[model samples]
Target chain A: MTDWLDHLLILPILLPLAVAAVLIPINERDRTLKGAIGFASTLVVFILSMILMRLAAAGTGSLPGSGVYQLGNWPAPFGIVLVLDRLSALMLCLTSGLALAAQAYSMARWHTAGHHFHSLFQLLVAGLNGAFLTGDLFNLFVFFEMMLAASYGLLLHGSGPLRVKAGLHYIAVNLAASALFLIGVSLIYGAAGTLNMADLATKLAALEPRSRTLVEMGSAILGVAFLVKAGMWPLSFWLPTAYAAATPPVAGVFAVLTKVGIYVIIRLHLLVFGTAAGASSGFGQEWLVTGGMLTIAFGGIGVLASQAMGRLAGYSVLVSSGTLLAAVGLGHDGMLAGALFYLVSSTLTIGAFFLLIELVERGRDAGADVLAVTMEAYGDFDEDEEEEEVGAAIPGTMAVLGLCFCLCALLLAGLPPLSGFIAKFALISGLFDMPAAELATAMSAADWTYVTLLILSGLAAMIAMNRIGIRTFWASIEGTIPRVVVIEITPVVVLLGACIFLSLQAGPAMRYMQATADDLLAPLTHSERVLSAPRAGSQ
Target chain B: MELILSAGIGTLTASGVYLLLRPRTYQVIIGLSLLSFAVNLFIFGMGRLRVNAPPILDPGGVGDLARYTDPVPQALVLTAIVIGFAMTALFLVVLLASRGFTGTDHVDGREQRGD
Candidate 1:
């Protein structure tokens, strides 16, 4: 049973790749067979991920230390390694669950979208799982590209002028980021003489101070590339546009795209850069915290300004990015736990919101004239015609849209009794407990800025939700309402149910998050545990 | 040697950033390629400069660890190069497709959409 769990780590990635290969020979016109294989495979992967989660929770020490399955039995530091720890397991589960639900939604929505959907969807899953599990920097790059390639296909799954336009920018930005990532990785390897993360961790510390400084600078530049992928502010301009133009199911799964970037940042920061002796070291914790705060501010403003449901959901993802980054910046185990907890909640909530956007769009074509007429009826028609046009939801999708809007609002606004509030409270409380030694050296201005920014961002999110929610959901309009289809409602309902379940299971989830965070903060325990195990094929 | 490599990296970074900010998509692609080259060189250099020594161990060599340049970065760079090529190809394909579909090569398709 325990050995089985070790094998399960590879299944999530492998299943998708196998299915993708098998589906290629089938005619693209065979939508039924394609849909069946796609949905079933994703479902199986989801179940396997759940089993891995259970095994991880049971604390089965199958391979001893954190499990590292080196491909081809090659020794660590020489060959590629797929590491499965509590964090990776958690991410795999979230990704699989979301992928499964998105597939289910796509089955009905993309009946005519062609067979490329299944292949792209499966490849995306493979890429994500690979990214999560890879132990080497170079493998991480490979997986990132794999994921991006699949995303390009998925983004344009339903080809249209808007999608093509948005996708071009998305591709351009990400290509630039990939290039930067390649450059950064090369620079780091050149300086450090190792690409294996654990080895880099050990070697990075022993390098000269100047070299160490260069490595840190290189790491920060790499960090920017991931940040762009994660949709952090200043670099996030491409996100909302691209996300808005993508099909709902693709957009729903794509919500996890930026989280992958956040995952890499957390992994690298905690594993490699966390070893710096002093808090003020070049790659120290302060920069992450400051950047996170700035991201939160920018995300909150973007959310407020967004008129379209799809764009608003996209901005909400950006806000979540800020929160998670800030938590990483704090560099405390508890803060990271809070961040991780929030990560799960935000992914679920944002994914659900994307699905709901499809429902809203399908309900009514919110044309400019219709919006203008409605605004005229309300006697407050001063907003731009485009803005008015974008806000108009189809009449029939109103109920579903309202429900999803409420769920999104509750999660994003951090209202109590929901996962969002609990996650936020945990992070804020963790920040509050920073030790005197850590706090005393910080400038008072920076501290105040941090607290004020967090609070203000939270407030702005609530205000935006209220304003947008009232207009988009509660407002009554006269129009021809299209019927709400089962395909659109099912995934949103399933994800909303998950949001509720996670909120209810907050106790255990938070505990797991804390354990994962502790492992990250004290990576020596992880490194020693993983390294002590004999390599496969070693006597 | 190190100074020259460092200068090259700086020049690459500058050129890449400049081209990336350009309005045309093809220039951005070129910038990205140049940047990747610089980065690959940078990582290779990190293993420290060795004129002729490779990482392969001699069969009858003694237990001295200092003779070889580190092999790990080389392995990493090798993987990076292949993956980089794949990603660049994907981007180039996307650029071509965008040009075909929209009939323009602007970084942002907004101007073309307006027209």
Candidate 2:
């Protein structure tokens, strides 16, 4: 039974791949079958993720500390290993849950958009799960490309002028980032003499200072690649435009995209970089925190300037990016715990908002002028031509939209009685308690800058919320009552319920995040487990 | 050899930066390619230049193990080359598609946005 749970780690990744492969050969005309498969696969992934999370919480004694599945039974350091720790498990659960919701939302709404939607969605899930679980750096790059390729197809699934335009830039920027990632990995391998993350951690400390310096530089370059993916400052200009152009279901699922980058950074920081308090340590906690603060500030400003609801939601993601990175940068166990907790809550909240954006767009004829013409040629919108399009805030949809907005506000503002507030408070309190004479003192000016930036960003989000929310929801507009589709509403309600649950059950959530953080902070136990695995030929 | 490689890297960086600033999409693509080549070489060099020695583990291998060239970088470069090729191909396809769809190949996709 315990061994079976370790195999469960691979299921979240495999289920989607299996479904996608099976569905590809089937006729594209069978939209019902495709939707059924897509929904079922995503649900299974979510359930499997929950089981993995439970196993992770049970500790290494119950299961392997880091569940490593060797493909074809090849020994470690040679074949591909799918690793699942608490961090990966948490991310997998969040991603799968969000994906499940998004797929449900798309069923009745986007079914006829194209036959490729279901397949691409499954591939995206497979890639995301693979990226989260893979232990090999090269495999990580492979999964990243896979995810990007599927994303390209999905991003351009509807094939509109605006979507294509946005998709082109998005593809270009990500390709550039991919190139940089490869180069950085090559450099690290050159210096460290290994690609296995565990091996790198062990070998890096023994290298000459100059060699170490080269590796560190390589790591920073790689860091830039992840930061670009995370929608960090300066490199993130392409995000809002691209995300806003995507379909609501696609856009909502993509809210987790930047989180993948942050996840990679956090993993590498804890496992490979060696987060020791010394000059020799390559852990860039300070850099991450500073960059995070800048991202938060930039995201807040972007939200303020955004005219559309989708773009506003996109900016909200950027704000959360800053908060997550800052918490990680604080370099305390409590801060890391808080950041992880925030990660789960924000992912759910953002996913919900993305779904709402789709529902709101559905009520209006807004899709016609912007997305309809490009899509009309493809023959998906004619059947629904007779139906009257509602205004941006049809009464029934407005209520759900309002609830979504409140959730978004709670998340962005980090308000109390919500998961966002709890996560932020935990992180802020941890920062305040750090010894005064530590690195916090050396970087006091920068520290204070982040503190002020974070507080101000929250306030800015509130103000932006008022500016956008009031106009979209409260202002008078003339239109018929749009039919509120259950498929769309169900997903939003499900994700909203999740946010509420997390907020309500903050105690256990906080404890689990803390345990995960502790595991990262002191990885000696994890290292010992890997080393303890019987040596080849010795056995 | 080291000086020449350094000069090549510098030239690549400068040319890439210049092309990136250009309004034309093709030039930007060329710049990206040049930059990738420079970065690949830079990463390879970080393992310390060894002309004859291979990183294979053998009792009969020449020189002390410590003095041998690092194989890790080679493995990394191999993967990097593959990924880089995939990206370059993807970008080329996208650039061509953008040209076909938008009827322009400017950096910003739209000529007016360049202003």
Each candidate: what lDDT? 0.78, 0.77
lDDT of 2: 0.77
What lDDT tens digits, residue by residue, belong to model 2 across residues A368-434?
3323323334655445553555444346666776777777787767787888788778777766765
- What DockQ would candidate 2 receive versus the native complex? 0.45
TM-score of each: 0.88, 0.87
Q: Number of the top candidate by TM-score?
A: 1
- lDDT against true structure, model 1: 0.78
Q: Model 2 residue A475 lDDT? A: 38
State in Å the error of residue A415, model 1: 1.0
